[model samples]
Target: MFKIEVAKMSILFSPITIGGVSLKNRIVMSPMGMNACKAEDGKVTNWHKIHYPSRAVGQVGLIMVEATAVSLDGRTDPDDLGIWEDGQISGLKELVDMVHEQGAKIGIQLCHGGRKSKIPGKIMAPSAIPYDENSIVPEAMTEEEMYEVIAAFKESARRAKQAGFDVLELHAAHGYLINQFLSPLSNKRGDKYGGNLENRYQFLKEVIHEIHKVWDGALFVRISATDYHPEGCSIDDYIVYGSMMKEQGVHFIDCSSGWIVPPNFSERPGPGYQVPFASQMKKEVQIPTGAVGLITSGLQAEKILVEGHADLIFIGQELLRDPYWPKRAAKELNVSIDAPPSYEYIWNK
Candidate 1:
């Protein structure tokens, strides 16, 4: 493990503002779906209430909730959290309040599963395609259906605002609904929604536009930077998409790659393997970016920020292994951070 001397400071502990919201530090708890809503009714559960606030108590700067379905049919799993109806707002509000009480800002990732949904019944996508040979083929969405999905997103944004969320993220990655539309490999539509880059981008563009109408807070987008196929989207394509998102007032691009299809890893990924994608977007598109994937240590995260590769450090599985990761990171970097009041004696020492 790398460590900094006591005389030096760590940039990872610094504060930065995006879209008028100031974070306590540069560390963010990346969203990871737990699928813990045991009732399977798309409502927040006891697990969500405990899971998110624990990170806040651990001192993470920002906590991003898992992929929440924007519509009932859009859920990736039967038990995923939802923001579809007004009834779900109260539960979400409770989760948000709990996180805020512990001094951490919370955000939610609004998502649609498209063809990848594990729920029963007919699923929809830009084309009648299956994610893989074992996956069921989804029906092609009509223009009217697309408009309905957009409306669902808009309504979900309104619900997010009502629930007092500090940030809202549209999940456009991981071969989901918006991703299926963006990727030429899955989006075979001949009409306005497909066939070319501009056409493919229309679905996400409209989702952002509609969400902005209701949400004035920080807006973020998580995207799959590459498809790992020669015929699929590459870094060059995301540069264009990143520029478009910037134009639409997106605050940050959460850069994550692959999973647009089944795993075909040529080699095992190393730490910061996906940092290059965030770095490229930050430099080329000139928008704030969050680097994720295998970033585990304070030194590694700090180096990425110090080199101007990304604006934020998004931690996933690491935070799960240790909720007090920020505290651990502070020690590694020779910095001090305020601990929760109850733990003052131990932490302050």
Candidate 2:
């Protein structure tokens, strides 16, 4: 059922299994902050149902929900969905079910905003550096507080399971709680949680341990492959961190970059800017990885897979701008896609 036409570059449409979850194709719908939650307590809302099922109907392999706060205090926006409460599970369950019905797998991204924590006005970080003036200063988490956050992550994963999500994506990227731990420029603590790569990775490793116990599903981790700042997290550090994450049973490293700091020349920014990061990680670390960043074309995405640059490609804005991106791609590349017999008349000819 799958042919890896390397020369014709058709591997992008091949089936692959991540951890134990099989994907219909290699295309993933990467998480983008929609901030569309409408429930008072920030539970997944009807908008989520509408948002994700459409992607599945469009034929993407994996649909990763936006950053979901593991704790109330960790929320990045009032509208951001939260897994901290059991009340939020059923709505999300409905959303996941809808996606599955469309023959798509759904993953929920668990996150802690740290200094970027946009819980009302409260933010908590590894240090006091502000994410924005309007953003909360976020008192450094004490050991007790840190432990609480870890528990929070575990509980969130438990809730996600109860919601019937297929995967758990740890949002360790973008200068959030986990990113704060990894960045020397952000983490100034002299404690075991801050000084070196091992120390910086400690909190995340433990969080993974916690979530891992509760989530029997594939556990994917998103990483900023480059800090994009000369003084910040580096490619060297990223590889070290990726190796540690792999040892922790992370199923795939979703390659992303530059949210922890401003863009730097070190980051080769443009279309497919972050593909090299995924390529290098897969080559050196030998772990399954996903490439995401301005991936806009069927051929462009296919080349990444054909050349072994990434195991998966995610289309963000492109899909949003055109919910039928998959169908269009199928047509462009002369590939067949599944559509119910009733809808054949409605397909873009």
lDDT of 1 by residue, 53-80 (tens): 9999999999999999999899999988
Reference-based lDDT, residue 294, model 2? 84
lDDT per residue for candidate 2 within 81-181, as digits (tens), equals 88888898898899998999989899999998888765565567888777655654668779998999999999999999999999899998888888888
Best by TM-score: 1
lDDT of each: 0.93, 0.84
Clashing pairs in 1: none
lDDT of 1: 0.93
